[model samples]
Target: MKKIALLSFLMVFLFSCGQQAKKSETKSEDTPKEVVVMSVDQVLEQASDLAEKEIAVKGTVMHVCQQGGQRCFLMGSNEDITIRVEAGEKIGAFSQEQMGSELEITGVLKEVLTDADAHNPGAEHGEAEHEEDAETQDAHKVLAENQAAAERVFFIEGVTVKEL
Candidate 1:
């Protein structure tokens, strides 16, 4: 009788442990997925369709354009679509210091229609804010809001930055 009781208790303990492990595995699989990762060419191909669309892409950081203490642009190889980052946003996860490094950027891909969007002739990146208007400032906010609506771009908020 004593041997039977011991065996039953052991079986129950083992069964509970197995159930707990299965539950933990299910929880891990439930983690949120990331935005569709695209290559530079694929991103450009879908750029028109993705206007105002939040995108995440990995590419080599051809250059880093900095301005206004903390503002910076993480340019991909094509130089067509650069990811704009703000002062508080510059934890060095992506910036000029990261030039020549490969990186993954997640932001709202926008069209550079105006001259202001064009590169300046004579200014090192990280010098000064070109346009301090409410419009430009709001642009950053819009990007942030847009990102929030869909998905978290970088899993680490800012640390997920990849230098391609």
Candidate 2:
């Protein structure tokens, strides 16, 4: 009957369409993974969590180091929020021409103790030290606390730069 013919035709059409869909979709290991790019504000907000990790940030170039183009600062929507980007071995230097230009920079986040924190290694943190006999870690505990307390500068060591 026509009903049986119609059902068979419908099943055949559905199977053919499914085969085409499978052929159209493909996954290759050689394909590069997509990187999650953060804004300047996000980078500053998540500085501690993102430290030592490679990150991509988009912002407007606020200023560039003039001496030898070693570094540059990126400004977020909030003028107070700015992240420093330093030239890595790959980047020779940030040019003055980048000033006011919007850019997406990829780099590894790094933090260093400030001069004030460096002056006093073991300032006041006493309880953080766990080892009783091995007492040399007092400075390490205090320095870790100081670094956690925002007494350090967070900068990104630039790996690549793209102007957008």
Candidate 3:
């Protein structure tokens, strides 16, 4: 029967066309690309959840603290996530002045989750441990005071310096 043959051919062609359409739809879904801009808390959570995992974060400079004589951003906004900038070794060469201005820093997010050897586990105690909390507290107070004293409103360096 000619009608039967024609109907079979039409059905086969329609089914094949449907499959091709389905394949194209599936291909788009298969590739997953996701980028998220996380707040400090979210960034900290992600850093803790997946240590050494590469991530991107953006925030303004809240405070800059000097630990081990190198400048580090004591970064915060409404929340506090004591994230540090990568050391000079990691960032090549940079200075505290660079941090004085608003910045969009991109680096590995690291957190010291514990300091079991000392009190208040996870408190970053720099290169040496303190004998007691008071002594450590005083030392930090003094160190902070010293840094505060030396703190300048602005720093001029490199080509920015003038011959006045």
Tell me, by lDDT, which candidate is best: 2
lDDT of 3 by residue, 79-146 (tens): 34545554445444344565544444444444443222123322564557556678767766666665
Count backbone clashes in candidate 1. 8
Q: Write the per-residue lDDT of candidate 1 for residues 6-35, one digit (tens) a residue.
A: 999999999999999999999899986578
Q: Name the weakest run of 10 consecutive residues (lDDT summed) in model 1.
A: 151-160
RMSD of each: 13.5, 7.1, 13.1
Q: Which candidate ranks first by TM-score, i.e. highest? A: 2
Q: Estimate each model's TM-score.
A: 0.42, 0.63, 0.38
Candidate 3's displacement at residue 109, Å, is 2.9
Candidate order (lDDT): 2, 1, 3
C-alpha displacement of 72 in model 3, angstroms? 1.6
lDDT of 3: 0.49
Clashes of 2: 0
lDDT of each: 0.57, 0.84, 0.49
